[model samples]
Target: MTSLLAILIGCLYAAAIYMMLRRSVVKLVIGLILLSNAANLLIFTAAGLERGVPPLIEEGQQVIAGTAADPLAQALILTAIVIGFGVLAFAVVLIHRACEVVQTDDMNEMKGTD
Candidate 1:
């Protein structure tokens, strides 16, 4: 599963880069979102995948002393998701404003000296 997930992440990164290189502002925004998702996935995959065990510990235990899913990964992913959403939203807004002024979503067309 880890190997498969790793491959998936690689594919996503490749696609994201490909999209980012396109001549469309919309594609660039999509690529940014993909890149963010790929990063989150990489972090998730780096954290070991374990079966669903509550990440809890008894009061006397100094730590979670069993096979429990790491909460850190979940927390990190959650934070990334929120931040990614905000970034994506901002990018979209910027794109919209650019389109309104430039009258096109093409990167080449957006380059105006005036």
Candidate 2:
């Protein structure tokens, strides 16, 4: 399962880089989204995958009894997701306004702001 996820993450990163290298502004945004997703997956994979175990410890237990999910990783991923969403929204709005003003979605054409 982890090997599969690793392969998937690598593909995502490749796609993200490809998109980011494109001249289209929309593709750049898509790439950014893909990059963020890949990063999240990387974090998840690094934290390791556990089965049938809760992330929290028992009320009376000083520590978890056995192998359990890392709560910190989960929280980090959640926070990253929220931040990614905000970045996506901001990028979309910025792209929209740029397109409206510049009358083009080509990054090359947008360079003539002067």
Candidate 3:
């Protein structure tokens, strides 16, 4: 399952990069979102896949130490999600303003004084 997830994430990353190279602002924003999701999935997969085990320690369970899912990766992914959302929001607003002010979304058209 982890290997499958890794492959899917790789594919998503490739698509994101391709979208980022396109000429449309909307596509670029979507590409950034896809890239962020791919990164989050990669982090989650790197933490390993365990079965039938709760993350928290139960009372009187007497389990072995250091054989549990890494919570740090989950925390990091949450942080990355919040940060990515902020970045996406900012990018959307910036793109909207750019389109409004310049009357065009094309980067080539924004160039001037050359």
lDDT of 2 by residue, 1-114 (tens): 999999999999999999999999999999999999999999999988876478677888798777877888899999999999998999999999999999999999999776
Which lDDT tens digits does candidate 3 get at residues 1-114?
877998899999999999999888888999999999999999888887774344677787776355666778889999999999999999999999988888877777766513
Cα error of candidate 1 at position 48, Å:
0.9
Listed per candidate, the RMSD to the true structure in angstroms reads 1.3, 1.3, 2.5
TM-score of 3: 0.85
In candidate 2, position 81 carries an lDDT of 100
Worst 10 residues of 2 by lDDT: 49-58
> Model 2 lDDT vs. the true structure?
0.94
Who is ahead in TM-score, 2 or 3?
Answer: 2
Residue 71 CA error for candidate 1 (Å)? 1.0
lDDT by residue for model 1 (1-114), tens: 999999999999999999999999999998998999999999999998778678887898887776889789989999999999998999999999999988899988889625
Per-residue error at 53 for model 1, in Å? 1.9
lDDT of candidate model 3 versus the reference: 0.86
Model 2 compared with the native: what TM-score? Answer: 0.93
Say which candidate scores most in lDDT. 2
